[model samples]
Target chain A: MGLMETFFNLDVLHSSALALLEGLKLTITLGLTSLVTSFAAGLILVLGRLYGPMPIRVIAIAFIDIFRAIPLLVLLVLVYYALPFVGINFSPFWAAVTALSLVASAYAAECFRAGIEAVAIGQFEAAKALGFSWTDMMKDVVLPQALRLVIPPSTGIGISLIKDTALASVVAMPDLLKQALQAQAFYANPSPLIGAALLYLIILLPLVRIVSSIEERQKRAAGR
Target chain B: MTHQKATQPFIKITDLQKFYGQFQALHDINLAVEKGQILALIGPSGSGKSTLVRCINLLEQFQAGTIEVDGIEVKEGRNLNKVRAEVGMVFQQFNLFPHMTALKNVAIAPVRVRGISWEEAEKKALALLERVGLSQHAHKRPSQLSGGQQQRVAIARALAMEPEVLLFDEPTSALDPEMVGEVLDVIQKVAETGVTMLIVTHEMSFARRVSNRVIFMEQGRIIEDTPPEEFFGCGPKTDRAQLFIRSVLQGHPDAGLTAPLQVLED
Candidate 1:
């Protein structure tokens, strides 16, 4: 038999599909939890960097730079293994979330900062002239407009984070990649690896398309 | 002494000085505006006319003077929100909130700053828009409206705040010539309401028609401050003010016809 027949055996493909399906639920949950945590943290960091006092601004900048510089793999290792030495122990799932969110938040914060800065200074001046306090302006006018401007970039970040959840398998979280590896070992074939790639494609293709369309609409709205 | 000497001015500025890095933008300026008075400020570019108006509302800080708006002193580290809530400013660029409709732009401050109910704010905003002849366009955003229409909405927005004083910083200078008359007409109507106002403008005729007093500045110093008729009457005043009026009015033959300064010059 050809290599394709060996790899694409019906029995192996069926079993691989079943195993991967079981892992999808955990993968989705991991993606969602990390995304929400990262987005909220990112907003706070962006605001701190942009409008906070000197001490907070310095700390936020340092945090963003450090997280962005570290590889996700190293961060996961540090959170899962090294953190225990400091008497802080998190389960593997919590470890994956903490590590992924920290790294994702750094990138998202940059995206939010760029979006907020892109709004005209005149908007703030007008809001101030109307007697809006700093916090009021941010909540009522600035953030609403900035969020609209950032949708495409933030979606890009979200899609990247979803794919990065696969890295959780390193800490043995039994996510999609881990389940596929187990199937590969059991079946002694690479078919499960192919199935995992297809699953990623299925999840990410619609997200990528949505991001592109939003970018196009934004450009058109800007009269470019 | 002037008749205004009998009553204290609602807005007062004394020994005002402003600096931008190494450059001085305003110097030792003293001025006052009585309630129900309309004062016009006209000057060549870089003369700090706009800066002076900005200083009154605490939009620009002066280094050496005190500005009192309706008894609230303009100072750093004070609760400026109370002062701002009482002073409404109209900008050269209109500066309407682009994301909101005209009605919302006019209504938002009353709701957010004053804690007025949304229903009442919207109702009052609609009335203000009607006063500006923009009732039919209440739902339009700044980006959807013409420059002139947007400015009218801005005026209505300022009016909705029920401010003690209104400051216009060259409100019509950014409009096309044909569009200027509509905005000026709306301002004239606003003036008729007897609201205290300070206007910084280049429209000499409108300044003469609507203002009780006109102030001319050069190099950050007030060259002359007098009644509009006297300021434009070719009487004894700063030569710089005379040259500025002449240059700005050069193309219009019928300029100053009502207050014929040319005859006085001859």
Candidate 2:
């Protein structure tokens, strides 16, 4: 086959596009649930670090550091494979969700911590001066500012979570890549994988652009 | 919580001492302010003016001695929430939350801290924003405003707490040369309402014009506390005070009332 003929088969592309589209629901579902669960967990970690007791903060910190150090593939395997031996079995879907959330929250914690630390010392002083209770200080003053700052990097993490859904296929969750694999196996052609890669790019590129534009607008607003 | 309106000085600092890793930041600092006095603190950087102001509300803890605000003595386990609530501070950085609109910034303290309804606090915030000449920009974020406008919003935020005393730490020091006047005007208006103020500022002329007394500090100790008239105008008074006066007079030859006051730092 000619190089163009191999890389650009319309039949392969069409079949892959249809199959990947069929898998789209699982891909998006995993992405969104992982993003949310991990963000909630990350919030818990951040708050634990900020206001939790010293030992609790230490444990949370270790969790962040440890999860960040492990490979996501290795971590996914552990969740799906190792835990079942201990009778803490997670179904494939839960295993992927659990593993991705673990990885995502580690990054999310770092992002959130940076955002919180960016708030000035004077703010806490002012919060105290305003008669805010400790809870009120976090809810009213610190969290609002910190959350706004986290938006851009956070969206980047969201994009990463979406991309990471491909790892789910390794655990047999049958997401886009799996469908692409099945299509390629049936047709004895590998071009559908390239088409699948193209589809991933399609999903990611615009989200990155949107985050960049939001970042730009924030900078302009900050300048005023 | 119930007491007669103070016949005694509202804030009293008696032999207060603070140490920063064995370096003394405060040295037997004894000071007092009547309920309505506007005291201006002037010093070189690191002279502990900001530290002293912070100690008043226990924002910075002192190692030994007492700070009394509204007749309550500083104690480690004491409920300081009331004292803190009744004293407001404006920072050198303005410190308005950049993501928050001016109205939201001003309203947050009252609503969250005092448990006031948001609607009521926002109504008051709008009125206070107008007082500081920022009503038109209430919906804009702090990052959208000039330094002067942001500082005014900060003052309005402080005022929203209805503090018995307002503390300013070099409030206009970070401002552009042209923008200092508007913030100082808002502060001046706040002072006129008999709000006790302990201000740390480099604006000698503004200090002279607005403060009832000027305090000069060096090396964490007060060198002189004099009416602005005596503090700024002479030589050979004390070698240090004389040196300070010359520096001020030479640097700001037209600093006092004689020059048409432009709010510029120059």
Candidate 3:
């Protein structure tokens, strides 16, 4: 029962490793689906802030502020537990995705809005002078540049989204952390915790590299 | 002046007035440009020179005025689509869409605004980009290129719309000194093709070199309007024009038409 032998215990490690692998798929699925939804929703919200009529702009601002203020854990508990009584039952898998995406979208929207506005006012005028309509301005010029400006932040958001998937385990979605917990319970050893940590690291490390490299390039470009 | 008979006075501005909340930005401005003529709008920044050109395409909706481009009468809330299609405008910032390659940036209005097929629009975009001396940079995004190259791309984007008149809003003002020459060169080439142009610029030498007529505006009014030759160097008809020339030459743009001189002066 020495720390060294416990660390290398093949049986405990094997159980958790298998469970981690099984949970990895759901984690990825949740991350990707919610990421896409958040991106789309965020983009629209940014556009609303920029060009929408008064009511629309107000709604967008309010949505972004309110959700951003709320804790993600509270949002999750509500979507998973409270909504069912109101007749909005969803599987724990979907509940986690919905809650995460809503919060993510709020933050993403703010990021995009700031990015879009970061483009010089002259860019918009140039588009108009060049005979582009409002929508064409976004499709051709504004969003493209703004998206580049926002890319590093958005990728950083992805890491948070992936980590956030761990919260899904609380709702019984069988994501990696939850499986790790179950394996620990079954094997009666904490060695499985190491496997879980390894899985989180494996998923997050490359992303960290990508985020930093891209962010570095963005900075270089900005300096130019 | 060998003013083109068929080419006609392609642009006419009548009684254009603009107010920004109670402050007047442009007041009772009037101007005219014959076909193939290069008209330079020269003045201090807030002199309403840029505002006038922007109004021709309704980029800024004037409180009261009428603008006729070619044969089309432009007024408030009227259909500007056709007028914008026929008139090309370039801006100082060279707002080529950052998301697009120079080629895609050029092709967008033609494809979307003008309803041209994407392939056809792209072909025209490439040719025009070449004309502006940016053929090599057609596939690069705006950020990847220098300011001069981006402005040329902006020019190419405007030309792709095939407008009868091109507008330049201090096209070289935002450029670095080294980059100004290249963008002005592109503009000069466009002028050579006999397309009509209206430009607002502070590059006094450029205004003289490229303009057939240079108009000086001050405090939302046309202080003086004269041919390039008379607009610079020396003059009898313009006490205002002579004074503007000497100040601009000495790099003292103090003729506060937009912002007061103190902030820039001391």
Candidate 4:
């Protein structure tokens, strides 16, 4: 077959577009769910690591270090394939989300820690001297400032998590990449896979632009 | 002196010794402050002026000390908020919450810590902004205000707590030269309200004018503690304090030695 027929066949892409759309919907759902879960889990983990008593801090540190070091694909396979042998069965979707959140939460925790530490010591002293309780200080003073600082990095994590949703296909979750693979097999053409890549790009490009603009704005704010 | 009815001092520090990992920051410090008295702490840098003020509110833990604020003995593991609520502090950095408007900065502690209604706290906060001559700037964030205005807001924030004792740790040290007068004016107003104040300052003229007592410290020890008139006029009893004062006078050359010397005649 010629190159266009093999990889860029419009007819094949048009025929498979509906199936790809269904997969894209699932991918988005998975990505959003994991994004929220990981972000929240990251916050809790960071708080524990920074403020909790000895055992919780140790456990949080271990969890962050181990999950951050593990390969996502290996973790996905382990969650989907190994856990069933141990009498714990998660559906493909839950398994994918579990694996993605575990790894992404570790990254998110580090980002939050960096942001919190970057807050000036004077800010903490001011809050403390005002007689703010620890919880109130974090909520009203420290976290608000830290949240602004972590936006660019955290959004970078979110984008990577969305792209990682493609890895869900390995566990039979029928996400975008899996659907693309099926369409390619049925049509005997690679155009469906290229079309799936294009769809991912369509959704992600704007987010990438937003992250850069936010970073640019923060730099400008800092410069002033 | 109207608030000095209690027989006991409002704040008492006994044998206060502070350390930072084997480096002593304060040594054998004992002091007493009566209610409504403004005591200015003067010393070289690293002489524990800031550390001593911080210890009163338990912002810095001491290795050995008994600091009693308004008769409550400060200690570790005690609820520091209880102590801090009664002792407001103004920092050199101003340390105003950059994210908040000046009004919110002044009002937040009262609303959150004192459990006052937001509406009431804001009203009081506005009055405080007016007192500091920044009522028009109340809506601006710290980033929008100049350093002096920010420090005034900081003083207003501290005053909103209605603290019995106020600590100013080089309050005007961080401002541009032109801005110092405005902040000092607000501090003078606060001092007039008769809050017991411990001020760590390098402004010799301000210390001589505003504080009743002047303390000269060096190497973490108090070398001179006397009435501001005596300390700045007859000059300090200790040679160390005398030398320090002479150097300070030489640097500023306008710290108003003549005024304090005139006070000696009166």
Candidate 5:
């Protein structure tokens, strides 16, 4: 068979489309769930590391360091396969989410820390002089500015998280990559895998473009 | 108003000592500022003038001293927000919230900290912007405004809190020469409202014109404290102050010193 017929077979793609669609749904669900959990957890981790009491700060630092150092695939396997030995069981879906969130949260925390530290010291003093409580200052002044500063990097993390959802296939969550592999075995064609790659590109390319545009806009704002 | 003696100082500091690591920033400072008095603090760089003003509002912690603002003593672990609410500070950098417009910058503290409604806060903020002659520019962000306008907005933001005392820490030192006049003009108007003020400034002429009293500091101590007329007229009482004033006059030809040679001879 020619390359197009073997690798990009329209007949195979049409036949396997439904299965790929099912996988796409699960992939999106896992990616979005992990993205949200990681972002929220990242914010908490950063706040604790920066402002919490000594014990909390130490725990936050340790968590970030450990998760960031460990390979995500190893952590995923351990969470799925090893945790049951200790009687802590999670479903394949949850295991993937837990592993992804742990690692992504660490990266997100570092991104947030960088954004927060970039804020001028004068901003803190200004908020304090205005009688804002520490919480109010963080919520109303510091975080808002930091959020603006962090969008590009944080979205970069989100894109990576979305791409990393493919790793969920190893846990038998039947995400896009898993579905494509199954389709390839059933029909003896690589078309479904190409289709899955196309779907990922469709979702992530716009996000990549958005990050660059935001960065450009921020640069222009700074220049002004 | 609570019944208090007319002789009581509105803000008082006694034996205040501040340190940055092992280096002393302020030494044995004692000052009592009456209500409605505008005092200008002037000194050479590193003379602790900014440090002294900053301590009044508890922005800088002193190693040993007492600071009393409106009868409340400032110290560690106290609810300093209440004291800060009563004392407004305008920084040399302006420090306006870059993300907020001028009106929002003026209104945020009142709405968030003072518990005023947003409508009321915005109304007061607009009025303050008008007072600062920036009412039309209220919708503009700090970056969109010139240095003078940003500083005016900052002054308005501080005034919106309705503090009894205002601290200006070299408020115009960061502005261009042309922009300085507009900001100082707003501050001069703020002074007319009878809020007690302490200004750290290098503008000798403005201090002489705007302040009832002038303080000179050298090496973490107040070298001279006298009425502006006495301090600027007969020159400073101390030899160091005399030499400092002479050098300042020669450095800035536009300090409103009519005769540099005459002051140098003194």
Candidate 6:
């Protein structure tokens, strides 16, 4: 009933350590898979929005609008539960990933589009004048510069997606949050949730620092 | 300097017309640029000098008429890459690729378009940079270089393609007054290489010194197309050309205030 006994109970912490570790593994796997898939999907959407013919552009726009408008939890529930009635049932993990990646791609596409637009018109004109085809121009000139420009924001999206992975617990994925809640119920202690929170901080703190430093460098570069 | 025969036109434009929405930007423009000729286009702002030069490279498509560079007509549906590679354009803004080094800026086109080896492209690019007196700044990015140096690097980039003709759309117009001389000096050196060039410039003296021919445009029309000496000297043919010459001379403090008086006297 002391502060240390209540908040930092080593006995409870030790008991929940194994469950927390398993949850961490799921969190990492989900994060990495979702991140890669979302980034790829986002780039495609960005390209479609920027350079596609009319039909593709309209499709990209519609997809982005719908995914971004829905909450990730609602998306997860719909994918995991509602899709079973449509004969397209998915596992909890896959449902979580699909929802997360879809929403993340929508946001990431907007970030990437902004980055591309931030590049001056002259760069495109210069690339064209230098006899670069559209593909070469985008690959060699525009994308490199634009990706550099959007690093800070893209990292922000990454951190956000990382946190949003916790929402996968709603679909019974046995991810970090779900495992932590289960451990808390079994031990009748809150320490597992705190441990999970600490684990998240440990993983994300370096990334947060990296993003800030990158932003600082970008600011100084802009000033120059 | 030997001039190409009058019969051989390297660049020929006939009945060129351009419009932006309802406003006419160029009207009934006809011009011919012989090979190796340094032609200076001088005109007041809003006079279509830039538009006409841009049309030569098909940067701005004309509403009507044809532009032929080395007898390759510029029009819709043509593969412009080949023709564009043959004609290098330097913008007034010195649009250097900010991400690349000076050497890379000059080397990229050859490597990307000409399918040359990187080493060969860099070798040619370095020689061009040296020609422009920017060899020391080869590793520097465009942002690190001064405006004049960036423009010089742009000229080197344009030259690295070994284009048959170079287009200058107000090359010196974006430079600081002091830096203008350095860019013009490099341009003067480029002129001596016998490459045909069309320069839209406001530097009347520099144009007089470098141009074989001078074109005067007004209200989207060419008012005078004559030798530089005649265009800059004893008389400008039309009253508008005369007024322009007087105004240009009068604006230059170096003109000693008597030059405009002489034109007025005439």
Q: Show the colliding residue pairs in model 3.
A: A141-B97
Q: Pick the candidate with the highest TM-score.
A: 5
Give one digit per residue, the lDDT tens place, for model 6 in B1-266: 12334586988999999999999999999998888899999878889998998887677878998888776777655568777888898999988988899999999999888899999999999999999998999999998999999999999999988988999999987788779889999999999999999999877888888999999998899989999888877778899888777776677443222223233232
- lDDT for each residue of candidate 4 in A84-180, tens digit (9 for 90 to 100): 9999999999999999999999999999999999999999999888889899999999999998999999999999999999999999989999999
Residues A1-224, model 1: lDDT tens digits: 78886766667889678789878778889999999999999999999998899999999999999999999999999999999999999998999999999999999999999989988876877787888878889988899889899999999999999999999999999988899899999988888888888888999999999999999998999993
Interface RMSD, in order shown: 1.0, 1.4, 1.9, 0.6, 0.7, 1.1
Shift of residue A25 alpha carbon in model 4, Å: 1.0
Q: Write the per-residue lDDT of candidate 3 for residues B101-202, one digit (tens) a residue.
A: 889988888888878899999988899988888898889988899988988888888888888889898888787778988898888888889998989987
**In model 1, what is the error at residue B197, expressed in angstroms?**
1.0
Please provide, for model 5 over A83-171, each residue's C-alpha lDDT reduced to its tens digit, 9 standing for 90 to 100.
99999999999999999999999999999999999999889989999889899999989999998899999999999999999999999
Interface RMSD of 4: 0.6
Q: Across residues B1-266, which tens digit of lDDT does each residue of candidate 2 receive?
A: 43526566788899988999979988989898888889999866788899999898788988988988888876555468878778898989888876679999999888876788999999999999999998999999977899999999999999999999999989987888789888888899999999899999878778877899888887788778777767654422567766555556566443222223322232
Best by DockQ: 5
Clashing pairs in 5: none
Candidate 5, which CAPRI tier? high
Q: Please, what is the TM-score per model? A: 0.93, 0.87, 0.87, 0.95, 0.95, 0.93
lDDT of 6 by residue, A72-147 (tens): 8899999999999989988988998899999999999999999999988878877777777778889889999999
**What CAPRI class is candidate 6?**
medium
Question: Which residue pairs come into collision in candidate 4?
Answer: none
DockQ of each model vs. true complex: 0.69, 0.57, 0.42, 0.85, 0.86, 0.66
lDDT head-to-head 1 vs 6, winner = 6
Q: What lDDT would candidate 1 get against the real structure?
A: 0.87
Question: Fraction of reference contacts reproduced per prediction?
Answer: 0.57, 0.72, 0.67, 0.76, 0.83, 0.52
Error of 6 at B85 (Å): 1.2
Worst 10 residues of 4 chain B by lDDT: B256-265
